[model samples]
Target: MRPKQVFVANHTSMIDFIILEQMTAFAAIMQKHPGWVGLLQTTILESLGCIWFNRTEVKDRVDASRKFREHAHGDDNNPLLIFSEGTCVNNEYIVMFKKSAFEIDVSVCPVAIKYNKIFVDAFWNSRKQSFTMHLLQLMTSWAVVCDVWYLEPQTIKPDETSIEFAERLMISHRAGLKMVPWDGYLKHSRATIL
Candidate 1:
């Protein structure tokens, strides 16, 4: 049998997961969203075998990790989709990828998504506005344009740690979009404190 595939992407907006979902029939690890989105997550997404967790809860994260590792190693036919940055960032930059996706022994396919802001900003700042607001803004805008590149598949080297593997994949992702590298979680934390 062929090695299992894990698709990883640099997340810029809420739609990043949805866009990737259209390309392949793969299950994803996602944050448990709120409102109508949460309803969909608990129903539609859950039906697809997607794993959901609350990012702020330590137990939820731990549980998700265990479930993710099991899913990756399982005999399921669908590949896994992961937004390794763990949170959304503006399109101008890419944040440090979480290493969990790389921890698995599977082929990693790095996908880069770049958005054109000529019409409207696609970044969904959930702290400032809700997903409903984001969608309304998009609906009123001229259009949302983006470019997605499917880079060559990567594998963790025999001697590499998961952190190193994640960094390497981040580099490949950065190559296509020319995004500034930043730790998204750090930015989020700082915003929370301020």
Candidate 2:
């Protein structure tokens, strides 16, 4: 495992972070929303070194970047895991990756995660149900299958922009997961079948 590598992956469920954390000690960057903040803070999130990001405000985003850099550059042994897709979607598709993770001046490890809903639908429909509701759904289910793959680490080419690097990684994730590229601009449209 590279000391300062950023693991970029397609978001599937909240369980994605749990699964990854079980495998290795890594700090996962998550979006900060009012609904689940208290629950997350009181639980293992804080202990696991998760970074809560507020994507709406410029100041918050900047602060998040700084914290991310500090954590990535710190003496801690954990690598950083960033779900560049920005939000979770049904296993059918993957959205365009956010470019922040790609901008990190370090090797990037692209990851692909696929979930099997043999027992229950593990995809957290954040729009319709609350995180707690979805979590209860998962808990009551018979099983949730998680498949994670760590692809090769890549370095940004001197001539390549962060967006280009992110796109390349996105392609790899899509191919690996056999996921369709989602083109909708609206977050609620993520479940749309094309």
Best by TM-score: 1
Q: Across residues 1-194, which tens digit of lDDT does each residue of candidate 2 receive?
A: 86777888787787887888777878888777565555765486678677876767889888888988887766664788988877777786777777778777788998888887788887877668987888888998888887777778998999999878877765445444554455324565446578
TM-score of each: 0.87, 0.83
Q: Clashes per prediction?
A: 0, 0
Which runs in model 2 stand beyond 4 Å of their true positions? 35-37, 170-185, 189-194
lDDT by residue (128-178, candidate 1, tens digit) is 997788999988998888778887799999999987787777544453455
What are the clashing pairs of model 2? none
Please report, as a residue range, the 10-residue window in candidate 2 with the lowest summed lDDT. 175-184
Angstrom error of the Cα, residue 50, model 2: value is 2.4
Badly placed stretches (over 4 Å) of model 1 are 1-3, 170-182, 191-194
Best by lDDT: 1
Q: List the residue pairs that clash in candidate 1.
A: none
Deviation from native of the Cα of residue 66 in model 1, angstroms = 1.3
Whole-model lDDT values for every prediction: 0.80, 0.76
